[model samples]
Target: MRFLGNFLTNSSRRHAAAILSAAAFAGASSIGFAAPALAHDAVLSSQPEQNETIKQLPHEIILNFSGEPQQGFNTISVSRDGNVLFRGEPRAKGQELILDVPDNVRSEPGEYTVGYQITSSDGHATRGGYQFTVDNPDSSAAAEGSDDAKADTTATSTEGEQGESNSSVPSWLLPVGGIVVIAGALVLAIKRYRDIKKD
Candidate 1:
């Protein structure tokens, strides 16, 4: 009778272990599914789109992204001839970052460049720049104005260049590690249960 009970208990343990192994496999699969979401978001379009010329400098520059950017984690700066006209304090509105040029800094025209650093929804930093020319007679002169635009595109909040934005490691590492730990614990528990059953 005791032998039958022991056999039944071991069978139950194997079944439990099989369930745990299946759970760990599912967990690993889920991690794989979520891996793609870790990619950095990209700029879909921007105000005064790339290489576009404008009659006047718009008070605000808007950037539309492929995904909703993180709030308070983005920036925009406008400059001409390396002279920064306005450093924008960008705000999030849906999938766009709106940077309002300060009143005092507006009105300059010339070849202006917009540089940005933004944190995507998945917590990746993206940085890039685009240029637009402002069509004003004084734009050429303004290009030489005081206070060169902050040319440092890679700010503390932003990543380096676009080429270096991709992550080298796989995103599933953490989740896989977690699953391994859980599986190990489950195995140890099963082994302990067998030891006690044998006794």
Candidate 2:
């Protein structure tokens, strides 16, 4: 009888350990499944579209995103060659970040890039750029009323960097969930061990 009790106790310990291992595995799997959602927002489409050539720059530069970007700390900059032609704050509307191009800003026929930094819906800062060509041979290369164009490129850059540093959400919630699962498993195993002792 003494030997049998010892064997049963050992078997019960193995069973409890198995349950703990299974719970840990399940928690890890759940974190893996959630990894994709941890990614920041991305641009789904834009006004000019990537690499598209157009005769004229639109009055509004629109960027459609996969998620609704939050309001504030949003910027749009249009550049050609090394020159920043336009840089300004953009308004967020649902999933769209819209920049109303100032009438004074003009572009020459060449490749242009639209760079953006916005507060993503998940509260993380997201930055990206896309290029489009302007084939408007009739338009002048120099931006008209150059003196009127906002020369706040440095400020915009600084603000964007600050926003990125400030708006971070913890990338991993796995440790907390894993701990909970392990704790629960331990509690369950303890209860089972007590029940076996009583039996």
Candidate 3:
């Protein structure tokens, strides 16, 4: 009986050690899997920063990232009232991505959204967006009882005549989708670990 007890105790210790080793490996693997995504370049700052209000529309919109963004397949789009007014590839300069507003692109905006997608220096695609307001009092001149009201009306009409573009996908879609995929993978790994533990 004493010999049998010793063998069973040794087996339990071995089994517990195996589980501990597996848990440690799984923890390490999860961290490794998520490291790249977490290290992807982040926006350090923007010219027309999030929720900022400016007196005039900037000629160029600039986004500064934590690391230099890779060129190609990069996009920056500006929108107001659900209409995309400008959408184009930005000029990548060091850690800054700049989008020049077209000479003909005029805006009388209350709030505008700047959305972007860029190849991260870490080689992953990252996307995000921010909002800024253009509270140019001159924009509302057409509604005022002033001599220049008629001219303002004509300008507003011209702006309307220059039809707007629409963005089909949200800028945050990629990052959000990546997060979901990663979460699912981690859940699957954990489920497999639980099955092994059961055995």
Candidate 4:
């Protein structure tokens, strides 16, 4: 009877220790789960300095974020007088997004809107816009006329270089090269086998 009582006490103590340990582990895990949720807020900072006026228009617009975005889901739109001006693909650079603007954006002094939507790593989405204006319309017009010719020339030269580089490689050469190497190896193996058989 004494042995039975001692056994029961020891078993109860062991069960109690296990329950306490499980509770402690669960409490620790619960604390860890709250961390990611707290860090998931979407934040955005954009260039052209919200409401800034510049003499020269920027070739590229940039937006820096607090978190990495979901690929293929982020979008940026620039407009002047409610007409969409730039709607191109955005490239991600670390936590920043760089968008290439159209080369022919009207440099005339007027209010423009830059709108953006970004989805954060934790799936939270954020959206916002800011306005900026060009102060000198005539200056922009003259700059545009001068820049138009230069931009076209630069684009043409770049395209020509790319085309030349691509034309240097014949599409059929890759397969032909592979086949030649395989045939040479097969011929060498056949000769070696014949030599071995003769020996």
> Model 3 Cα displacement at 22 (Å)?
2.2
For each candidate in turn, the TM-score is 0.51, 0.59, 0.63, 0.50
Specify the highest-lDDT model's number.
Answer: 3
**Which residue pairs overlap in candidate 4's backbone?**
none
- Model 3 worst lDDT window (10 residues): 160-169
Across residues 1-199, which tens digit of lDDT does each residue of candidate 2 receive?
9999999999999999999999999999999978755878899999989999999888899999998888889999999876899899988788998899888876568889999998888788889999999897455533443433445666788899999987774657668888999999999999999999999
Decide which is better by lDDT, 3 or 4: 3
lDDT, candidates in the order shown? 0.82, 0.87, 0.89, 0.82
Candidate topping TM-score: 3
Find the number of clashing residue pairs for candidate 1: 5
In terms of TM-score, how similar is model 3 to the real structure?
0.63
State in Å the error of residue 92, model 2: 1.5
In model 2, which range of ten residues has the least summed lDDT?
141-150
Question: How would you encode candidate 3's per-residue C-alpha lDDT over 89-182 as one tens digit per residue?
Answer: 9998899999999988776757899999989998999999999998877767744656577778989887776643334467789799999999
Kindly indicate the candidate among 1 and 2 with the higher TM-score.
Answer: 2
- Best-first order by lDDT: 3, 2, 4, 1
**Which is better, 1 or 2, measured by lDDT?**
2
